[model samples]
Target: MRALALASLLFFSAPPPAAAVAPPRDAYPDVARAYWVELDGKPLWAGQPDKRLPMASLAKLMTALLIAENADLAAKVTISRGAQQETGSRLGLRSGDTARAGDLLTATLVRSANDACRALADWRGGDQPRFVAMMNARAAKLGLRNTHFADACGHDAPTQYSSVRDLALLARAAMKQRAIVDAARLPSFRFRSGAGREYRMNNTNALIGRYEGARGLKTGYTPGAGRCLIALADREGHEVLAVLLHAPERWWDSIGLLELAFDEAKRRSRR
Candidate 1:
């Protein structure tokens, strides 16, 4: 009888294995190569967040910030040969097409248009080389030591890369601009060029309208970068931001991180 009681006590009192419970922050360990989670501007959890990696279209977030801070949004930008001819995602602007800085800004944030991003950079930096230099300079000022931009728009490059930690800072700065948040959150936009051509753009971020409490941010993917996301959410006044890098399951992982981050924040506050 005493042996039976001792066995029962040992079985009941022993702690459960770590895997028997959900991962901390519900981290998508299989896909999330590196990530950073923050609630109310306090670090909640992370995984190798300082590891520099290709950011892909996430580069546009920084471009949008610099333009928003340094240039006049209403200024007219005459589409240069380079802006119209750039490869990858584009607004389909012609070499002679004209647009305001604000319009290109919106397109870059919403649709991840490579052309729109280049146009904004060209207009503000006067040329790509100059613009890239400006991007680096801005990074220095922002104290993003792990960030470097090869282009205004995220294109896979040997020198272009950013860490999850560095990108969260960039996103935080970008979010301060109401226009950027509006553009990111916009469900869809129909932009008519000065050439009288209509171009319809849609948000590439899966979380924009589908995820409850989600706010404006960005998404990125490339063969080299895999899938990346900078996501923001506000749940009952507990605002959370998450940066996931090289995630094969970016949308799902990001949603999980955001949801869990908020849950953790609430749990702590209640304690």
Candidate 2:
């Protein structure tokens, strides 16, 4: 009984475990100027998140979001001459081509097809400018304070701009839509041209198949925008959204940023 009492006293008198120290934020190398936000049960690391920059193809996220919100995916749309003539990262769709809204959306999101995006906008909003207005409206509704849309296909325009933080919000909102998520996550997809030619389209978001836990997002580049990426990844019940703007090497920067985010999340989870 004396021994037991002594042991109990010792246990009660023992010091508590040492408090955990957080990893320093500077541990991650400066790969690019970036803005990261964790949402829907995730974490964020941001830099100059509100600085507006040309979005390039990442603007398609907004286009996809608008299409998913306003149009039935199964609806058919006739490809216009204007849509066919759009340049940059296209599937070579021709004028007078017709395809289902779902297929066009798949092309737009997975392949970053400029022609497909323009077709979707024309079909949904009756014209490119009107569609851009809708995109701006959607941005307003989403509370994206630093975003503006000048074109539907992310073609270079003086007014087309978005910040990393704003794009993160857009990506998060788009992920909530099943169709958008499905289209974004595909490694590769097929779209039937207006002329019934089969075109195999691959995702521009290189991280989808290359990185563990990577799902969907977008990539962009222009002489003005540099290289940009909005990347999403899921791991161990945690989701992270990372955005890089004007990155000299987008793929390398994105991978580095994601690695940092995952490490930070894990470190916090153990605390």
TM-score of 1: 0.89
State model 2's lDDT. 0.77
TM-score, candidate number 2: 0.86
Instruction: Report the lDDT tens digits of candidate 1 across residue range 4-68.
Output: 44334323333222223433242334436788877788766677777889999999998999888
Candidate 2 residues 85-194, lDDT tens each?
89878888877878999999999888888999999998898999898999999999999998999989887788999987788889889988999888888999996755
What Cα-based lDDT does every candidate model obtain? 0.81, 0.77
Q: Show model 1 residue runs off by greater than 4 Å.
A: 1-28
Runs with alpha carbons beyond 4 Å of true place in candidate 2: 1-29, 37-43
TM-score of each: 0.89, 0.86
